[model samples]
Target chain A: MALRVGVVGGGQLARMMIAPAVELGVELRVLAEAEGMAASAAATAVGDYRDAETVVAFARDVDVLTFDHEHVPQEVLAALVDAGIPVRPGPGPLRFAQDKLAMRARLAELGMPQPDWAAVAGADDLGAFLAAHGGRAVVKTPRGGYDGKGVRVVRDPDDAADWFEAAQGAPLLVEELVDFSRELAQQVARRPSGQMRAYPVVETVQRDGVCAEVIAPAPHGGDRLSAVAASIGTAIAEGLDVTGMLAVEMFETTDERLLVNELAMRPHNSGHWSQEGAVTSQFEQHLRAVLDLPLGTAEPVAPWTVMVNILGGPEVGDIDGRFAGVMSEHPSAKIHTYGKASRPGRKVGHVNVSGFDLDDVAYEARAAASHFD
Target chain B: MALRVGVVGGGQLARMMIAPAVELGVELRVLAEAEGMAASAAATAVGDYRDAETVVAFARDVDVLTFDHEHVPQEVLAALVDAGIPVRPGPGPLRFAQDKLAMRARLAELGMPQPDWAAVAGADDLGAFLAAHGGRAVVKTPRGGYDGKGVRVVRDPDDAADWFEAAQGAPLLVEELVDFSRELAQQVARRPSGQMRAYPVVETVQRDGVCAEVIAPAPHGGDRLSAVAASIGTAIAEGLDVTGMLAVEMFETTDERLLVNELAMRPHNSGHWSQEGAVTSQFEQHLRAVLDLPLGTAEPVAPWTVMVNILGGPEVGDIDGRFAGVMSEHPSAKIHTYGKASRPGRKVGHVNVSGFDLDDVAYEARAAASHFD
Candidate 1:
């Protein structure tokens, strides 16, 4: 029988895994929240991931369980573990991904470098954090925040009064906003048995707080930074007991320090360039890791690879409608689209270009992605 | 709406297409001969492909109709074309692939290089052809032949008397068995609007009349041979008005002459290396050609790519059981399984290894594929 993997979300990450799953001869079943989600083709069950009964029922047939997102409630995950289901990135490590405050605390406990942060339960707590951090800081909800949601740059404690009310007595995470020269992301895959592999660090560009583009191997990163990024990524993967893929979003401060910015326990936007640039894509590596299979090599296939997101898709039609223009203009660009409807500021697709010349690769990726704009 | 493609057969070719279709955001539906075929994931309809009504019904909702293999009856294909369904490599050209006699005649008419051949109705006719070709020749049934089936090498006319009887008055194709140094295959994709792109010719090795290995951009094929191979592939595609992928298998003779051996109107085994080695895979190129979308570049990502077939999987368990060993030993090899039940001599999967050095790539691919044996 083929190895069966159950994924508990129907977003693009799940959709991307379908390709590698099919190629690897692994049966991937997705528990999608709705009928027409991005991973609908592989969705075998439609139910709320929060419902232990639903998620457990879905995981019954699969040999291992993974996730497309970090939103499954701790209780639901614990229920699966209690039921003897192999939930990778089990509730133990998932707690950190599901809650920013937990991740910050865990990183600090592990002696990992991170921006100074504090758990602020009230206005007074937040005011004190801001006062010690040049009167400016970043406030974030401890849970349920992604892609700039539930995060804010505040100059005063009063600026986050509404969030504090929403938290309802729970502490929110507040951190000093470090002055960074650029944002970089490092990814590592870890198997349940402790095997690990790290992809090269990449530089990510964001617009409106959403990932706009990514350059693999992070241009001008040099040997020290690359080694440091990989070390930090591997250290965290081991410290958190993270199985499957872990993407560490980090800040390269003006003072040459690499500080942990965020943590994602699933395939992230920053690793998308690896789909065409690396020996093994994160989607494929994630499946291998979660299954406890040996990890594939994470070497880069090309010297440079650039990825540009096609946010919001085309203005009038689906992303497919723009294939002709983009394919003809940039034959070497690899276009990947999420089966999603066009909506302002929504991520609908991405283009990847890999070659020896970084400039040409970036230009081709950006030009091809522009067609979907 | 996403562009939908309907494939007439549910074999490995169709199964492979699903990965690219999902990644490209195109909807693919397949008509399988049975419930649990290789392409079960995309098989929307289960019926006989030779039945015109069944095929037509399956093609109703798709934007374009294509094939996983060139075995769909001419009548069934005609019905699809008559119904105004966009059938890529339409009946007009598919007839050449369906009948070897027809293909030989057409290629001769087009002034192409091929083995000297004749259509023989009885032993007497066969005897005459064999007497003139060094008393040894190859005889083949014009229809229903694949993987060395329905083909025979005869030293005397009486050797093929059984085949002559099976013909029942229809003529069998007889050809001079030319001595060749090696075999090679060239693939070309053509759109309905005449756009064309050719992939590099690759060398193929046959074991027990089945393809066992392939080396992309065939070693020792200099600029002149490469150009000639591509020209022949494109010429045949254009001459036959074939839209989608066309594979032209040829013999590189001892005297350096390239002669046409066979034709396949769908993605063939020789081009499988492209899935991981080339910028645009044959499966993806086939989809683009059939949809009339601009073709992607058919450029190799590495200096060399070697592919080895995993015939007749493990004697005890499924291919998945061997992943740990193979993956651990050869992390750079890309393995692709067909999700088929293992049977003696069946093509269960393949491994692709690409890198700057051909020797290492070939060794890694072979080592990885050996795991399945």
Candidate 2:
């Protein structure tokens, strides 16, 4: 029988996995939230992931269960585990990704480098955190937060008064504002058998808190930086017991120190460049990992690879309308779309370009992506 | 609406197209001959491709029609075109692929070099050809033949007596067997607008008339040979007014001449290496060509890429049973499996490896494929 993998959530991540699953001859079934989602092609069950019965039913026929996002409630995950469903990045590890407060606390226990953080229950607690961090801090909701949502910068406790009230005594996460030169992301894949592979660290360019571009191996990263990033990524995957793909977003300080900024227990935007740049793409690796197959090599196929996302897509028409123009001008650029409608700030698609010259690859990727604007 | 492509057969070629179609956000629908075919994941219609009514119904929702193999009947194709559906590699060009005798005659008319051949009506005609060509020749049924079927080498005219009796006065195709040192295949993609891109010619190793291995760019092929191969491929595609992908199988004789041997008007086994080796895979290029979109570059991603077919899978179990061992042993080899039952001589999967060293790539690909045996 072909290995069957059940994925919860039908976002672009789930859509991207369909390609590798088809190539690997694995049967992938998605539990999309609704019809017409990006991953509708593979979605077999449509229901809320929060309902234990719905998730348990979705996992019945699959050999293992994984995620498109880390938002499946712990209660629903517990039910699946009780039913003997093998969930990669089990609830124990997923809690950290779903809640920033838990992730910070766990990283502290693991001795990973990260900014100072506190769980603030009220204005008094928030005031203390702000005052201790140059009177500036980042406040966040511990649950259901993604992209730039549920996050805010605060100079005064009043900046997050609404969040404090909404928390209703549940502590909100607040962290010291990080002063960094740039952002970087390190990706690692780990099989249930404990085998692991790390991709090179990539420099990410974000606009309005959304990833705009990424450069594989991070130009000028040097041996030490690459090694450090990989080591940190490996350490996190092991420490968190991440069984599928893990992405660690970090801040490169002015002093060259790497501090954890965020964690994704699934394929992240930073590694999208690997689709054409690396020997084994993250999507393929994730499938292998979830199925407990031996991990593949994560070596880069070229010296450089650049990825630029097509945010919002074309204003007046679908992304498909721009294919002729973009494809004509950039023959080597690999364009990937999510089958989603255009909405301002939405990640509709991306273009990846790989070659020996970093400048040319980056320019080509950006130019090809610009057509969707 | 996404660009919908209707493939007329449910085979491995159509199965491989699923990956690129999903990645490109193009909708691919296949008309399978039966339920649970290799391309069942995308098989939206299960019907006979030879039936004009069945094929025309399948083409109703798609923007353009193409093939997984060159076996669709001309009447079915004519029906689709008559209904205003776009059929790539239209009936005019597909007849050459459907009938070897027609292809030979057309190539001869175009002044292309090929083995000395003739349409023999009886034993007398066959005897004369054999007597003039070292008392040996090859006879083919000219239709419904693939992978050694319907073809035979003959030293005596009576060796094909049964075939001649079955022909019922219809001429059989007979050719002088050319003593060749190696076999090669060239692939070219042309859009409906006439723009074309040619991939590097590759060397193919055939076992029992079935493709066993392929080496991209044909190691030891000088610039002259590559140019000649590309030119021939381009000429065949343009001369036939073929749209989409075209594969031209050729023989490199001991005296240094490239002679056309066979023609395939869809993604062929010879170009499978391009799935990982080239900047644009033939399946993706075929889709773009049929849609009349600008074609992507066909440059090789590495110095060499070797592909080895996995025939008949395992003796006891399915191909999935061997994945762990093969993956652990050859982490860099890309394994692609077609969801099909194991049968002797049946192509169940393939392995692709690409690198700077041709020897290493070939060794890795062969080693990985051997695990299936």
Candidate 3:
């Protein structure tokens, strides 16, 4: 019997999964919004993500419902779960991911360490948050923020005063712009049967607020930090009853404290290192976890693995030369190109390098993954 | 523009090439017997390998001509080349691969060390050959023999009564049985531009005339054996002006001699170790070599890597349990299952495992790939 998986979006993550899913004999059905999308499964039923009827019908033919993105409406997700479809990171848990304020409120109740934050309804609320944290505070809309979009460090309330008035009217979250040393992410997989596994915590570098690179085992390594991050990731999965892959993006502060920055319940870009670095690639592990086919080994293939994101900046034209140079120079580096068109700051692809010298690989890996237009 | 690859056969090698070709953005077009074959480029023109007209038409559309098997008639291949299609391992070179007598003649002319051998067309010639190499000799059809098929060992002349009576005369080759300790394979890739690269010699174990397992960086730590085998493989590829992959199956004699037994021009089963063990997989390297793209690194990903073939012997039912059990136990083992139905001694699939422990992983990998039945 073939296990059917219905993905809600048609992007590269879904596209990359096609190879492994087909190889594993798993039936992958995609309810993509557009035709000619990468990784569009053969069982694809093209439809709009905004349409609940299309989504529900797509779910009907699948054994399990998963996602390629978190853009689906809560109402649509609830409709699927209401009809008895086994959706990973079920609506109850996904709501926390969709609504940042609700997530902060819930996590606050759970006693997790995040930055000091407050929900702001208007300029007055923003002013109050600014007063509590420093004079400057980071303002983020409760929904639809990714890769630095919908996020701003506003020194004055007048900056987004008019736009915030017309948008979703959803309460915004305001936090102090912490002076962080670096950012890190923890990738974990969980099964409905309560089995769980976590990969090593990796330090991520952000450029223009988008992930530019990641260093595994976190620079200035400490076994305790890995344990702490893994424990937190496990607690989140168990506490939320989350199923499948989850990536908890964290901020490692100057004092060595790890703070939750954001959460993703699918294969995230931060976990890309595992594709060539770990015993099992994050893509395969996500498929295994989603199918409940048993999680794979998470041991690192090398002592150190560094991943660098290839941003589609002004350097896009250098893809060809860079690829050749990287292949020739750092022969050990594993480069993964997403076959995407270039756009400023858009993620086009990435490169991973594994060796004993983590820092050296990180330097070479960044150069390898970065486009040179 | 997509790079066009012309494959000569639509068998499993072509089928396996589809995945990597698609990933590497090569347009694969096979000259198969019929449509609906497993390779990405299934033959659209229904014809025979002996028909030069059909093969020429197939080659016209493809940028480069390679092969899935060595069975294509030499005259047909030469005709296509004369018509100006770039047939890799050109007709003159491929003839050496097709006929054992041609290969042996060339090897002996090149002063390469191989088993003492001779070709016989009749009983008189066979008797003289047998007399020269003891009373016992291995009788082979010289052409159309593979997988322990059509080759036999016999002591008495009466044992040759049947083959001799049937011989009404096709060419045949007789050679002294090699008293070797173990068998090994050296895989190498050569480009049309005269660039060549060789992977470490891998120890291969055959059972029931079929390849059962291959271990890379051959166990017992014989660095000299590996170097010699690699040199021999490189020499053959260069000597034959071969473009694409060349697999040299060699017998490591107890007297410390590496005797060339057979050769495969395309990606061979022996190179499966590159999937997980080497920095670049053989499939990927074959695509690169055929496309004239710069080759990738051939360094091993780990110190030890083992590969085991899954022979779907007749009468074995229910492979799901064994597959799932192995997956559950060895979460890190890279398994490749060709979606072929179970049949006696068929090459259904193979499992490649890599780690620090060669013997332990080899044991587990063989167990996982072998039939549970």
lDDT (tens digit, per residue) of candidate 3 on A126-200: 887777777898888878888888888988876668646866576788877887888989998988888888999
In model 2, which regions exceed 4 Å deviation?
Answer: none
- Angstrom error at residue B299, model 1: 0.6
Cα lDDT of model 1 by residue, A240-323, tens digit: 999999999999999999999999999999999989899999999999999999999999999999999989876686455578
lDDT of 2 by residue, A1-373 (tens): 8899999999999999998898898999999999999999999999999999999998998999999999899999999999999999899999999989999999999999998999989999999888888999999999888888888999999999898888888999999999999999999999988999999999999999899999998988899999999999999999999999999999999999999999999999999998989999999999999899999999999889999999998768745668988899999999999998888889999999999898899999999999988
Could you give the CAPRI-style class of model 1?
high
Question: Model 2 — interface RMS deviation?
Answer: 0.6
Q: Looking at candidate 3, what TM-score does chain B attain?
A: 0.93
- Which DockQ values do the candidates obtain, in the order shown? 0.89, 0.87, 0.39
- Best lDDT goes to which candidate? 1
Q: Which residue pairs clash within candidate 2?
A: none
Return the lDDT, model 1, position A94.
93
lDDT of 2 by residue, B16-91 (tens): 9998899899999999999999899999999988899989988997999999988888888889999999999899
Model 3, A333: alpha-carbon shift in Å? Answer: 2.9
TM-score, candidate 1, is 0.99
Candidate 2 vs candidate 3, lDDT winner: 2
> By DockQ, is 2 or 3 better?
2
DockQ winner among the candidates?
A: 1
- What value does the lDDT take at residue B65 in candidate 2? 93
Candidate 1, after superposition: displacement of residue A165 in Å?
2.1
